[model samples]
Target: MIKRKFFMTFIVFFFLFPLQIAAETIEEPDVSSEAAILMDAKSGQVIYGKNEFVRMNPASITKIATAIYAIENGVLSDQVVVSEQATKVEGTTVYLEPGEIVSLEKLIIGMVVNSGNDAAIAIAEHIDGSLTNFEKNFNVYLQDYIGVSSTHFENPHGLYGENHYTTAYDMARITQHAMENEIFRSIFKIQEYEWDGESWDTTIVNHHRLVLGEFPYDAEITGGKNGFVSQSGFTLVTTATKGDLDLIAVTMKTNLKNEPYAETLSLFDYGFNNFKTEVIPKGSKFTVDNEEFVAEDDLIYTVNIHDKVSNKINPSGVLSIYNGENEQIASFNLKSLSAPVTKNITDENEENWQANGFLGTMELAILGVSAIIVVLVIQKLRKRA
Candidate 1:
């Protein structure tokens, strides 16, 4: 009876242990944003997500793409003569008048820093010659190059068109890709700039409140873009840095402006605290079936701080990373970085065959070609003799 009780107790303990471990996990901060995501900027890994793929109005954050597109496709020094339509644009404006000329760079600054609708229209008109052409082609660029699978834009200024929608994940991805450009990166983070426009000479401040340091600059805010429309609610995409890790936080469809910012900070805090980056240095080795393979280069991935990472080398020399929960995070093919296993060759072709078996399907094709060549060479030698 004592043995039976002990066995039953053991089973109970085993079952309850997993629950206790689950309870001890770090809690994600509760925020009011209807959709949100936290991403690793380099790896494009989603660290945390809620409704990340759901499409919502992106508002002025659309300019992040427009800014990068102009920086890439338009010459900054080119002069643009403002048009009456640009002056008459309804929403935000830098107060442009017809016949006033400005550099493409100045218009980009106005559009990005001040969220000027007029400036955005001016950019679209100047770069692509018409809004319709700009919209059609830029959407293709966003899809084919930036690699956002689920986003659409009908205007450069992000005015509310029923077709203008993007996901939190897609926006984060777009922001990451945009930040890679030197010119676009320079403009996205500016806190304030003095404008000497024809009508407005006042300093137009960056609308990103955290970037302005109004919210304590606690998470090392690098840069960000925010957007709003009655239909889209409050939307924000922010980038922050900590040590070697650069992170992106995107929040959308919040009730108030500050709510998206609040959610963004919470997401950033949670990510920085709970995750640690692990690097498998270049030339690191793992063995499969007594044969050795070397890492092609440094492989970097982020994992939970307390999670145990198991590195598995399959027969094909592909390294698979498994988290503490035994979930496979990713896999990579490792190259034979060392000299042709000189020792293996010394041991005989047996070792070579053993090593080649684990190098994957392509290597098998190579072996077949080598065998055919060897047979052809032997036949030629016979003919000569």
Candidate 2:
């Protein structure tokens, strides 16, 4: 009777344990934004996403792409001739006069720090000769080089255009890519810059309130850009860091001015609380088929904080990371440290034999030709004798 009770207890415990564990999982954040995404900057993993791929107006956050593009393509020291059209652009301005000359770097600073639409126009003109050309070339660069497909910018400033739209995921990707450049990073993190424009000569402050510490949050606010138009609502792109984990959060199309910020903070809290960045250090060795492989660079990935992590290395040196449930979270190709060994054939190899058979057939044909040559030489010598 005691044994029977013990068996029943064991069954009950087994069934209930999984439920308890599932209950402990971190709750998903509740956000009011129409679209949002939280991404791990190191691994490009989407930690949390709500309609992240949906197209929406990105507002001033479009400037992040413009700034990075200008930094990469244009000479910073070159003086940009501010056009009359640039001075008359609607929305925010650095109050530039017609034919005013400003360094490309200073224009970028003003555009980013002050959300200056005029500076964006000047920078766009200087780099691509005109806004029309800038729009054409910039879209190609975003698709081919930056690897974002859904983002399309009709203009340099994020003022409302019917075709001017980007997804939260695309914005996160742009921010992630831009944050990698040291020059962009330096400019991005600036909370204030002294503007010496012809009409506006004062300290231009960043419009992102979170970046300026206007809100109370624990994470180190690295940099951010915010945008608003009646058509696009409020849009924001923010980057933050805590310990070894760096994150990019994008919130778009919020009704209120502060809603994007609130959603951003919630997303950050969820990421920081529920996940962590783990690095497989450089030179970490992996063995397959008695051949060795090593990581060429640190393989970084984000994983759930509570999950046990494991890795599987394939014969071709691809490392796949799995969580406790055996779900693959990330993968990286390792470098071969030794020459690849010719693996022995087995039942599992049969399926791939057709793919690999051509080389073996070529080797056999070469051997057969060599044998025929040797026999002909011997027969010719014998005939001569």
Model 1 ranges off by over 4 Å: 1-24, 281-298, 335-385
* Model 2 error, position 186 (Å): 1.8
TM-score top scorer = 2
**TM-score for each of the candidates:** 0.79, 0.84
Q: Candidate 1 — worst ten consecutive residues by lDDT sum?
A: 336-345
Residue 266 shift from truth in candidate 1, angstroms: 0.8
Off by over 4 Å in 2: 1-24, 340-385
- Which lDDT tens digits does candidate 2 get at residues 1-385? 9999999999998674653465367698998899999999999999999999999999999999999999999999999888999999999999988999999999999999899999999999999999999999999999999999999999999999999999999999999999999999988889988777777779889999998999989999999999999999999999999998999999999779888888889899999988899988998998999878999999899988866678899989899998777789999998888954576678548757865797789999999999999999999999999
All-Cα superposition RMSD per candidate: 11.9, 10.0
lDDT of 1: 0.86
> What is the overall TM-score of model 2 with all chains considered together?
0.84
> What local distance difference test score does each model get?
0.86, 0.91
